[model samples]
Target: MLLTEEAMKTAIILKMLSALEYDVFDPSEVIPEFTADVGIKKGEKVDYAIRVGGRISILIECKAPNAPLDLKHASQLYRYFSVTDAKFAVLTNGYDWEFYTDLDEPNRMDRRPFLTFNLTDIDTTSASELSRFRKSVYDVGAILSTARRLKYISALKTRLKEEFDNPSDEFVAFFGRQIYDGMFTANVRQEFAPLVKRSVSEVIRDRVNARLKSALLQNTTEAPEEDIDLEEKSEIETTEDEWDGFRIAVAIAARVIDPSRVVIRDQRSYCGVLVDNNNRRPLLRMYFNSPTTRYLGLFDGEVEEKVAVKAPVDLYRYADRICATAEKYKSAT
Candidate 1:
């Protein structure tokens, strides 16, 4: 059974920290309550405080496992973390851990956490980062430096993901004015939004494919499990329309998923857009196999139903179904 209360949630976090080799202590020794000012409340208690070199280095507050992790409700963390010499503060609910630092100003905590990790879903990179907080390797300066680097990187990835999914007027107009003739107008901005998104996705995928070819000792993008003997079989030629149709399917599905991670594979029978370059993670299979009557092979569980498409835009007519199929693959990743 899952813990749904604060007390058990704290136990889970302490166990994780212990496994990570952190010397944990109860609130009595750390003293969660503090006298900040004359009028304000005192004797407030934070859950656990991890110390290093006889000083607080990491302050943690735990909530129920099922509770939403938000900084607005963690105002106490923001306050307790202020006067302490600790460089890091954490808000967690056993499963979801949010790490915060004082990046904007000295002593005052930032409104948002620099990093968040799910106990069940943490990546190796995150695990390595969390390792820095261990009792054996605790370093305040090093941890703060890592926090600063990760804070900016996390922010950048978020901004780029947002733009990749839906290009803003400014983002579209930036590319529009360079290639387009005459004055840049609202009409032009409206015209290039979808075009910009498609063009960017195409460029990103092409670059990734090129890098994959270079990085994998010249191995094909097709993973070995697909058992595709592209070596004996000649490379399939992809026409302009097929490429555009792939981009069209990409754009249509981008609304419901992360379009940037979608990989395009030009195969002998069709052009496939997959999740994370896995053949099994199929989003849509374009059989522009017949130029006159193109068919879109959409997956429904084990069954793949082919729908005839006249043009790239025609695929938008099946956007709901297309996105729904992509969702399954995305969820798997």
Candidate 2:
């Protein structure tokens, strides 16, 4: 098939929808384009739509690969959204997709997308978010709640990254007032800006070192005592979520290998799901370092697949990959 926008939708987007277990439809066989009761003068046909429980749940608007899927591009989608009872609208360019919901006002689509997914790079976290759009587990209320949470979190993280890279005057002043007791002089503000940046860098470095030390210590016994004593020895604090992630990994691996061969090794930087008590033979690495984000690292030879996640169940997103990985290391399994 030619590499046109419509072809890309069939080649990539349609296949993805099928995999997600959505009952997808082309407008021709289904009822034609959805027209808004307001907005546009003439009714228009949507590129495609998906049904859950025999009702239109999502409207998908497809664009060419090079086209940007933004508010301007989604103007028609917003019009269609305003007229329908469908809770979600999707804009895609075969490579990237943006998901929108009417969170700010009823029947009015929010300008900010709740979640975005890339067809070329599907992370476990994004997969989990997409799962909510499935026919078997479509819950309007639950998805809306999660969308609201992620939308704000994404916005906050964007602002934080900007401040972290180049601290704004307001950003410096807000933090300076909390730390300094005396008058907030310009010199003090200037001094503390660098201090704040240095402190953040140090904290990140220390955390990385702590995890590396923990992993190395657990993997070997010949390391010098002085090296181990460089940092204070503290008990590993494993969260319920991490343990749940371990169990999910084990269960997925058990499909191809023996469950008994899988073991959970908790460390400072990441939790290792090892096979046959061998650190060299790692199945998955759980890096739930930040409260806001999680990462599952899986390797295939020289390539490492890092999947972002939000919960334990999200680990299942890579179940097939996990099983295939375990099978490759079948000697240890």
Candidate 3:
């Protein structure tokens, strides 16, 4: 069954809050749509108002899938935040929820989130951070610190990306000093500069690949085991095993890199996994009943397509084979 983007976002949010629900508070009390009027002389509905001790503690505004989350979209929420007793305001389109509080200054919300994670993107850390948002375990100080760190971390990443894309000579020299302690001559700097740039790219690519892998694994594990064929439970199980094989491909990628960089596509008749965040660019494709695994090229921007692999399970065995590959790469270098 195809999951709509809205459904996907809802599922992701629920998953993030899973641990919090059991350990933090009474999940039933965390109502989805609790209304409030700040006596603004007109009626406007907010998506949610988290109530505790018979008082509204938080307000939320949800948007539809893929909607741009900007300040304009947050106008109503901002207004509600000021007029009501709700100390926190949230804006989300399901996939990305940005949490705000009066951290920098009272009556003014901070631009960054206290916690942010996509439903399609979560790690153990993301899950743990999300747990703090549960009404039962609301700790203002803890959330504030987490938000501050995330805000700065995001800013630092943005700066780094910008610098990488437009590296000034001074920036290069500053990094050069840190790496070699002013030992390198101009010739050496020139030679080593490309290496530094390449390493930076590899780091980003590996991270992206790792994230995709993690998402694929989560998707595979959560997928229900439904019996599609009437006569053969065994056949259905076999099909499931093929999915397990697809998962194994992701598991292999996870061990190799950031785990988020691997993604899978399973469209009934065809199932495949991509090694990087290449947008349906399959690193390998598996024909359910076919006996081969395809070797799609690692791209060079353009000239994109896929090649075939003859052994699906064998490539799946790459999970088991990764350590040796890593060792070989290390030894070669």
Candidate 4:
């Protein structure tokens, strides 16, 4: 099932813990509604609390999808951190996780995390490093060290980007020396200015592409299937409201059919079961990733189903039936 932002965050965090070899205890055992008077008490709650030996060891707060970790929100977590014995704190919204530790002062967390990890997108090495946070292998000191490294790395990258955006005289001179070594002349500074600009633009483009690729990879991993055996599987090319109709349709089929029978090709677009060859039924006539779900069932010709979903994540909510629906779609075709 497509997971809601909150659910997704919880799932990813749990997955991280599992990867670290931590004994993934029940969420209910650790995460409980805030009942104590700990300052702000207007229905606010921490997303999770990690426990060790039946005692709270860490406090975690979660933000909604795409929400920024502004000062106000971080302060709330800070307050909670001070009150709890859990020296470590975490703030996450599925994609980015920021860890906090009170190394500088009592109840005051460092400006930087003890460690930071991004779930949906990360390099293999970064992923392996992040895996150390798993329940079993968790070492407070080790995490702190890693966090320090990440902080410096982050600062270095930020400064590099800043320089790339607004080149400095020193930066220009250094590159000039490397690229035009031995031929360096007074004119070399002016000559390499365009090169610097070009390099900056290329770096920006590469970063954008990396983000796009990560998103694509995440989508593919979420959508697990090769092809569905349904004839006349129609595919729609359009946008919708909250959820992607075609994806929901494909998921429905995926839930029901044998894993081999259902196949989701091309990630978001062009999905359906291949019942036979000469005929392919397209589930979606006009597809979209938003709320208004659309699907076409080709029994003989075409049948349309417009499903309204509350959230984009709900597309995968019906994972079981979604798979079943794929088989049904295949059989119908």
Each candidate structure's TM-score, on Cα atoms with residue i matched to residue i, is 0.57, 0.59, 0.50, 0.50
lDDT of 2 by residue, 1-333 (tens): 236987676555665565455434654323334554565657566777666666767888878885777678667877778777678988888667788898899988889888875543444455567766655567999898899998887678778878887787788889889989999889889988987777767877899999889867765753222232324336567777787677667645655566667777777778778786676777888998789988989875567678898766566567667767888888752
Candidate 3 vs 4: which has more lDDT: 3
Candidate 1 structure quality by residue, lDDT tens digits, 123-222: 4355557757656667778877878788877788778889989999988888899999889999979988999999989999999998887845533555
lDDT of each: 0.70, 0.71, 0.55, 0.54
TM-score winner among the candidates? 2
Count of backbone clashes, every candidate in sequence: 0, 2, 24, 58
Q: What's the ranking of the predictions by lDDT, best on top?
A: 2, 1, 3, 4
Q: Any runs in candidate 1 off by more than 4 Å, and if so which?
A: 1-3, 6-12, 24-43, 119-125, 211-333
Name the weakest run of 10 consecutive residues (lDDT summed) in model 1: 31-40
Cα-lDDT of candidate 2: 0.71
lDDT of 3 by residue, 1-333 (tens): 214645633543333333233211344445555445554436566766666566666777777765778867667776777677777787877556677787677876777665555433444344455546655667767777777787677667667887677665666767787778557777767866777777778888999999889876865644333333545433333355445455444434443344445555544445545544343334444556544444432232344334454434344323333323322323221
List the RMSD of every prediction in angstroms.
Answer: 15.2, 11.2, 14.9, 10.7
Query: 1 or 3: which has the higher TM-score?
Result: 1
lDDT by residue (230-322, candidate 4, tens digit) is 342344333333124433333233223322332233324423433221124333322334345543323322354544445433443343333
Q: Kindly indicate the candidate among 2 and 4 with the higher lDDT.
A: 2
